[model samples]
Target chain A: MWMIDLRGIIPAATVVGCILLIWTLAVIPMNAHLAADMAARGDVVVTPHSPQDRKAMTGVTIAVKNPVIIAMTYSLDRPRLPSPHQVAVEMHNTIFTVAPTSRRSLVHHAWVTLSATLLGFVIGTTLGVLLAVGIVYNRTMDKSVMPWAITSQTIPILALAPMIIVMLGAIGIQGLLPKSIISAYLSFFPVVVGMVKGLRSPDAMQLDLLRTYNANAPQGFWKLRLPASMPYLFTSLKIGISAALVGAIVGELPTGARAGFGARMLVGDQYGQPMVTWAALFGAAITAALLVGLISFIERRTLNRMGMGAA
Target chain B: MTPATITARNLDLTFETNDGPVHALKDVSLDINKGDFVSFIGPSGCGKTTFLRCIAGLEQPTSGDISVNGMTPDAARMARAYGYVFQAAGLYPWRTIGGNIRLPLEIMGFSKAEMADRVAHVMDLVDLNGFEKKFPWQLSGGMQQRASIARALAFDADILLMDEPFGALDEIVRDHLNEQLLKLWARTEKTIGFVTHSIPEAVYLSTKIVVMSPRPGRITDIIESPLPRDRPLNIRDSAEFINIAHRVRDGLRSGHVDD
Candidate 1:
């Protein structure tokens, strides 16, 4: 009932419309040079006669002299910057025309990346929660484990990804597990940090009230700390799930992944297929949105039932 | 005399702060009889709360002997001999009114039927019979505090220690809750140690009022009420009640002179 406000929707639609307009206008200039060259090769009269001289001219300057080629820019076989329509068509073909199980299918690749992301996310969340519990309850773990967990994130994931892949591959543990570990490594930090803060959110009065009941440690945790941590847990899960998806994609980059969104991005870029890469990138973004959206949906229902719903 | 439900002897508590030793309580002693409503009336930092915490085993007296029901405070705590109500309701936001009351029973290992029965009984007692499905945030401040009282009463502890449970409410709400609390005490006949900073509140509710002061929190005077057990709100205008309230005010003023 709350989300369908026309006020918010209209402004959002305007912003997206602005972006698409800007992108379409930009495409003419970006692909103009290629379009001009294609036209010249077709024995069409071009303003800048020599191919060498054409390289010196800006795409905007070249396209002005050959206005007929503006349409050509929007329909290149492999333009430098593909028009938005080209990308949309590519995405549509891969997502709809191809069989879901086929190698050419974007659905197959999305599912491959999604499976690893979900596995790693569950693993990371469980690990994160366990660590947060230890940090909150044990003085030694708080002092020792938290510092190490923070420090681990400082190492650049790009630099670390190759090393992780090679090390695991050396032991003959290749593919999904390696990708998942990378995902787990990336996702666990937020969950650990958020959960620790949440578990400690209870005031002295709340704790003392429980003490009056002589509640045991497990009872205190299950009854008080766990329930208190729900908001924080969901916030971290949103962040962690996105991070896990990034980790899975990055995990694919190092191993020449045979099938996945990351694999498509890598293969497309290397093979001079920018349309393929653009489609894959959008697919990953949509996947991230869906994952985060699902969490947000669940969060709203849960908090409303708990009466902690945001005003 | 009824058997003493709680006893404190020569109690002294000194907190060592950066500045120096801050005496929160000094040479404090008191006895709470079964079925008594004893109110500790004092200003802030008077250790009325600290003293109550001692009885509940939430705080350790630096030097003193305190017992609950002839057993050590710690032992009594493990036996769940008391229900403590704090200044704030402190109800878990996620729990409905009924669930919050059921929490203690669940922790104490009551059966499903017993938990439900006890929750319903206390909810009815607190006049919150229809608020079972309502969460704490949905209730008024007074209603929330009432639910908290019901929570404490649910486990049927021998003693209820309240530390200014209605201090945050307006006078009108406070008055209504005070009358309800008196009725609750009379019905349950449980020993209650209430801490408040209000003179009239102490006078109106307590069977015995222990007036105190801060800076080295200690009791100044203990007044045993001669008024009848059954009290109406207008009983505050009664000569005996006014006389007791006057004495409590005098005790409070004299204690403050030590500053």
Candidate 2:
């Protein structure tokens, strides 16, 4: 089992390693301006050394390489692109070093965004399921509502976000409600489409069998359709949760809110702190990955209990 | 008179499609008595299964009348007068074998104790004992069909309508299941309407064999078996059984020739 697990881990680790190598290489070219400025100001003390001497030097020794430019890129105070370690250091400082309740801490901002995401996910899932049931059972709803649902998604969320935030603000409904509404708007579509497909998954033979038993519509829905839809529903929820997080973060961007990952990015951009922005972006990504992982965990347990093994 | 358990008078069903109207069943008439093991045998598109569905009230005849236990098929359906077993087992994969069997009983509001007792009784009748907790995928194709048969019998309905239930199984398993079905029929004493394409299967299990033709499906022959009720598998080798099987085969050949 451990060997099988290693097979999966090895590919993922290799991909991550490749990405880090690319990012490290890209940083040298991107931050070359700052490095050049620092060198001109005589801030970089470069000591020329032989390759053998460089190998002999201790860890504390600041020996510049043959190019001398690559070493300057690693220590720039204001870089166009921060190195991976620079972002890591910034993340550690904001997430662990500071108090969690402080606005400067990444944890506080992430918590604010997460609350909206969760609320939106709940509302969106409920609405999506209800609409799916309606669409499945009634021909009129299928003909009328489905096309409109698809049309609604074509309208870009980025273009719609600021207008929604501004409109809600005008009506004095600020803060979490507007953000959550946006999240719901983005997340519900996948659920609606997935659930409609799931609920209709049972074949004609199964339906005829139910009819032979003289089962009513409610009985058919509860006994056959609902259980059949569960696997599809969980798959939709995974997609919906990630989309909801994106919505919440985007919502914070236009509203100029004081606390949230989106607000942190906005502040970082305005104040020219690329490190802060990179840290907050990574924080949001980690949060989204964790949320998706949690939903997958629940999905596995539920499907297993239903005897639908693995999926 | 055994008091006909099912009677059809000039029943016709025409399905209207975008292309045109297709006659699935036309001018078909038959009578099935109580405790009868009747098999409808025909080629594909012969509407043998359609006739069974009409009796189960899953399909409606365009004209004429069909009655079950001296009432309309719809009324009989609402009364839960029969159990249907599809070609595929059609067992809900999410539910265990026991749970699948218990479904109709639960829908009809049977008490918990009664449901448990009935499920166990039917499971034993189908020889599916001790497999109550296994899901449909965990069981073999033959076992799944047995579980389906057990499900239909769970409600203690007076009639069982089976649409080629063992059609998907291998010959060895099908033969074994055929013997079990005969035993089940003897023990339960219920009227069964079976549909099949195999002549030997029709001869082996059915007390009455119905031969039908396609292109507006209608019955051409109805042969009543003179064999005893307690039939073992080796009975298929007997002179009488071979004679009956030959007649069924001839009837089936004549149906296609007429077409």
Candidate 3:
């Protein structure tokens, strides 16, 4: 009756195999066609052409066949979208030759945004937890603080970005701090709401047990309420980290800054280079995924240690 | 000699709902001697739970006083004199059986060595020694209740207040727990004040039965069990036990409430 768990290695190996098979099928004919087109355009002249070359060209053409051409025709017959091989080359150059500190490479911008995103997420989550605790414990705080938090999100980040930038400049606080503050502001509400619900989710019987033990306010909070909120806190934190990244990017939008992922997107927009903008976006997405994945891993381990591990 | 553990003097409790005030308990009085096994049997909404809450210091008696060993229940609780078992198992789903048992002791700042020894002792006492690492959700309902009982026993409290401890279980499981509870009681001599709705349970497990009725919830009858002190599972089928059960039923059906 024992079932084998194939979560980690087996699925990964299967995906890799599928990817390799698709790659092989996609690239060989594409390489042959591109080589023929280059020769026709006089980009490369192969001297002393023989029957072997002609046979090789026919084999590649026949393998691609009529269906591939029909598919290409339906796709508007534009220049072929860059294949996996081309993307790999671009990725390699971006990582190595492109200056790590330069706005030309996505890695540089990703690092710039990542540090600020993490800092803002930590600050926001801490603030959110504190606020949630206050709101849960005191009616006045719930009435006063919760409404303002909800209203804060009513103004879109796009509209708010310039105003935030301008206000920070007026206060003589510019650069990283302004961006981090925006990130924190955007990230706090979800954590507050999620944690408040979780902390209060304990059933009546459980609360009664704690009361019967003569647990005071602090004891009950530490021993029962806080532990109950851990799952909620971690889930909201994952969402908050991504929101903080969005905030950091949005924070860079109105500024004439020389760094960060959003700054690169701005530079790309000014220069009319869509590839560079897309690359920077991909970099930011990967950074956010990695950060959230790391937090989720830690959460799972902590929960496992607490005997609340996944079923 | 041991002390007179718990005493309630004309205790009354009222809940202030938005609709109006709901009188939960009216002029209830009782005394529990040290190491005695007492059961409070009553119908639904009969303030049996409210009385237990007053003794546990979770709720205050509105117009009277309750004391445990000559001090207020709250004071005695701070001194770590009592353990409470609710109707639901009340074991934290996030903690292991061992961890749940260690919780109250941990809060009270017991040493690590002492905590471990007490945990082991209680687990063995409740026949859950190997289940220390299992979560409450992983165990059966019967086992979860036993673990909760073990948690109460872990702190070595002088008094145990149980509100409908076996009310949720099947007859087989309930009988099993009752026998084990008797053994634990015999071994530790911890005074127990149990609340239940079952007449047979009251007769089987109690030294003193306090029968109660609804509508302002007053004590109707108090009967001393005539069965021998050392009870096993076989005792439940005995003529003496049936006589006590019938007596308890009579008390319940008599519809007499002395307010």
The best candidate in terms of DockQ: 1
Listed models, DockQ each: 0.84, 0.83, 0.51
DockQ of 3: 0.51
Better of 1 and 2 by TM-score: 1
Better of 1 and 3 by lDDT: 1
For residues A47-103, could you state the per-residue lDDT of candidate 1 as single tens digits? 888878988988888888889899998889888888889999999999999999999
lDDT of 1 by residue, B128-243 (tens): 99999998888999999999999999999989999999999999999999999989988898899999999899999998999888998999999998878899999998898889
In the range A32-79, model 3's lDDT, one tens digit per residue, is 443444343554443214435544665346334423332332122122
TM-score of each: 0.97, 0.95, 0.83
| Rank ordering of all candidates by TM-score, starting from the highest | 1, 2, 3
TM-score of 1: 0.97
Query: What residue pairs clash in candidate 3, if any at all?
Result: none
Off by over 4 Å in 3: A1-93, A96-99, B1-3, B256-259
Clashing pairs in 1: none
CAPRI quality band, candidate 1: high
Q: List the pairs of residues colliding in candidate 2.
A: none
The TM-score each candidate achieves on chain A is 0.96, 0.91, 0.74
